[model samples]
Target chain A: MISLFLDTSSKKLVVILVKDKEIIGKKELESINDHSSYLVPFIKELLDLNNIKTNDINKIFVVNGPGSFTGTRIGVTVGKVLAFSNNIPVIPVSSLKQYIFSLENYDYYVSIIKDKNNRMYYGIYDKDYNDIVVDKYQTKDVFLKDINDLKNVVFISEEEIDGIDTIKPILNINKLIDYYKDKEINAHYLKPNYLKKIDAEDKL
Target chain B: MNEYKLTTRCEEDTISIAENLEAEKFPGMVICLNGELGSGKTVFTKGFAAALGISETITSPTFNIIKEYLNGEMPLYHMDIYRLEDNPESTGLLDYFDKDGVVIIEWANMIEDYLPEERLDVYFKVIEEDKRIIKFIPHGQKYEELCEDAL
Candidate 1:
């Protein structure tokens, strides 16, 4: 069975195809702000180069972001369209958790996606992949206020933050798919996991 | 105390002033522009971008709200906050100040609260067709120095 991965949450346009939890094809391009135009073409390219037909894919793993407003929505829309049309189950993954799965160090792991106006979308998890605290979206000042002194808390992210130390994430797709394989839901129920509320949330 | 005023008779005069400012461009420079419609805000931006060695046709980012030009000699982040007033929760607006690029905002008065402290604010007053009275207010020492030489 074929499983496709789609993530455009941050600056990158990431697409990976996994067969039986092993990555067979992937495209990870950095600093692609124009995800809407590049996403579909890259998906086709990934499948064509791998000699895998889209019909063969049984399920899809999509990162519904806590990242860029437009970039995340484009990825989510494509994933939803593919799932609903193909009648396949879609797994909605968090953009923050994608960073979390990249590390196994420390008792607690923090995955953060920094946004506009000194704000961030952060997820904190224990080693068991259980939430230590619910995911949040707030200014960096308010979020990092009391957590800076914790020794066991490790910050994991791909992007650099001012004055804050961060370790780069190495995404383990096999572990990711293994964790969310059975958590698939109907395409209609799928939505972008934007932790923060925006003015156009009710409209868009 | 760091304010300067100039009167321009035509579009060329405005373009010259923009190019003069662009000649002294540095990373992380924020230029706040305010004026009524047709007061040469976008025209000034185009001149500045052109002087910065961007070949692309520069246009107002009213619809896009914010547009980034990375192909230029320096990264140029252009924004128009006219329509953004309706949606005040627009995220990441101030983060551009630290991006090591030249950020020019049109209709900048709309987001006066979010404007950085170390920046240049230019207000345009239309005197007549093809004529404008421009006022430059430099906030901080860096911008004060910039205006002393460029304006």
Candidate 2:
């Protein structure tokens, strides 16, 4: 069985391919504003480099948002199209959950993604990767206040957050594939999890 | 007594400032917005709401007086005190200061006497069809640091 995972939830574009539970090829690109233009071609290049045909991919896994709105949409849309065209199963994974999957060793882990301003998208998880606090946006002050009483917490973040024991989390593809082997959803129902409303729609 | 001035070229710029300011938000934080009509006060509020993980559409509270959004990272108590010029006390507006939520008051100048001492005041001035000059006045130490961090 072959599975492909794609994540465009941040400034980085991550693509991973696995065949029969073994790692094959993975690509991570620093794509800031060019996700719409570079995503499909990048995916093709990743597959061609590994000599893996598109038909060989039996399932698709994608990080569906709480990050950059456009970036998340681009990856989700691409995954849905590829899955629907090939009649393959699609799995929508939370970028926050993926961060937790990267930190299974910690007894308590807090995953954070900085949003515009001092606000952040955060989630708290246990060693089993079960979410203790679901993903939400809050100011760094409020987030700290909420976690002030918790003991032995490790913070996983892309950037440095002051006054916290922070570590840069590495997303392990093998662990992720093993963890969510049965959580595939239909391609027709896949949607980006924006977690907030767009500015244009906020008017009276 | 610290003041910060920002010139925004468009609505997006105004919202960007608001979103940035939202990152430093804390419970019982009060933001006082003073601006003329169509001066992007609601735009700033909308940006702040979005940063707080609010999914519902945040409209101006002109008719409602005060609108509460409890689904965000923290509750957001939005107030448009334009109609409260004559009867500010009737609405129990000051009670929100201790609600453990972020409070944003539009046309806040009208209720000057009811405002807390340690609030951040933003005044918007229209420069062009799309341009705005916003001034941030921090009334306390926390707000002053917030201005420094956000600007």
Candidate 3:
């Protein structure tokens, strides 16, 4: 099945077009909050480069939240609208989960995204793919203490720290190809997996 | 889509309305307003002044690009970008955003190039003869909470 993945949760905007387990097209752009302008055009560019059309796409994956509020909304809104219009299944992928999945050979991993409210969007998971989060968001003090108490904890995110071994950012296409290829993963159930509420005027 | 529409109407003049609304704000907020040229942008500033508890008179700093009113509850940075040109390379009048106070920029469309990724984008336009429409959109979680509380 042809699958398309779009992630705009952070500073980097990632777009991947995958045909089953293999990647056919990919595009990346850097902008503060230019998601609305680039989203549809990036999709079109990817499709054109791969000689593929929207009609050939069977599934779309979108990163839901815990990142830029505007970026998350733009990506999800586009994904939802396109999926609904095309009658395709959409897989919601969490930016944090994708970050964790990027690490290689790490048993225990901690993922963090800055919430900018003196707190963090953080969680814990192991190679077994189980969450160890008692809370999705924790204050800086609490998060630091929890990290200090834990052993074999590798931080998987874009942020770098001295005590914690940092993992590079990983795209959802790479994770999907490595982990979900040939696996029985549900498409409709795929969601952003956010621990904290996204702040936006609509939500208010 | 539930089709939710919320309109905040005040019987008082623009200054009083803005002041009442300003009094209900929190830090790290994004405010979007929609009104016409003479529809009370400056009058709204007076309300913001009252909300910030500023004793000074609020005026339109149209030519100055932005003005700071810091002697209040929270720092109030008011801006008027009407004189700004709509060129992406110009960066417009975004230098006002880096301050510590709640930033309010008039004529946002003039500097769309430099708008924060997470901010409140207010659209101000005139509706009827004397009515003004102010549409507020909070881009991030911080602003969302502020909007919720303000509502």
TM-score of each: 0.79, 0.58, 0.54
Best by TM-score: 1
Cα lDDT tens digits, model 3, B1-151, are 0111234354245555466457666654445444567766676777777767899887887887667777899888787778755453233233234334677777766656456667766555566656666656777766665556654
Which regions of candidate 2 are displaced past 4 Å? A197-204, B1-151
lDDT string, candidate 2, B1-151, tens digits: 7789999998899989999999998888999999999999999999999999999999999999899999999899999988765555344465477467899999998878557778999999999999999999998888999999999
- Alpha-carbon shift of residue B148 in model 2 (angstroms): 14
Best-to-worst DockQ order:
1, 3, 2
Angstrom error of the Cα, residue A174, model 3: value is: 3.2
Interface RMSD of each: 5.6, 15.7, 11.8
Worst 10 residues of 3 chain A by lDDT: A195-204
What TM-scores result for chain A when each predicted structure is judged separately against the true chain A? 0.87, 0.89, 0.80
In model 1, the runs with Cα more than 4 Å from the true position are: A146-151, A160-164, A195-204, B1-10, B24-30, B52-79, B83-103, B112-120, B126-133, B137-151
How many pairs in model 1 have backbone atoms within 3 A of each other, for residues 3 or more apart or on separate chains, i.e. clashes?
2
What docking class should model 3 receive?
A: incorrect
User: lDDT (0-100) at residue B93 of candidate 3?
Assistant: 34
What local distance difference test score does each model get?
A: 0.82, 0.82, 0.65
**Collision pairs in model 1:** A116-B92, A117-B92
> Which numbered prediction scores highest in DockQ against the true structure?
1
TM-score of 2: 0.58
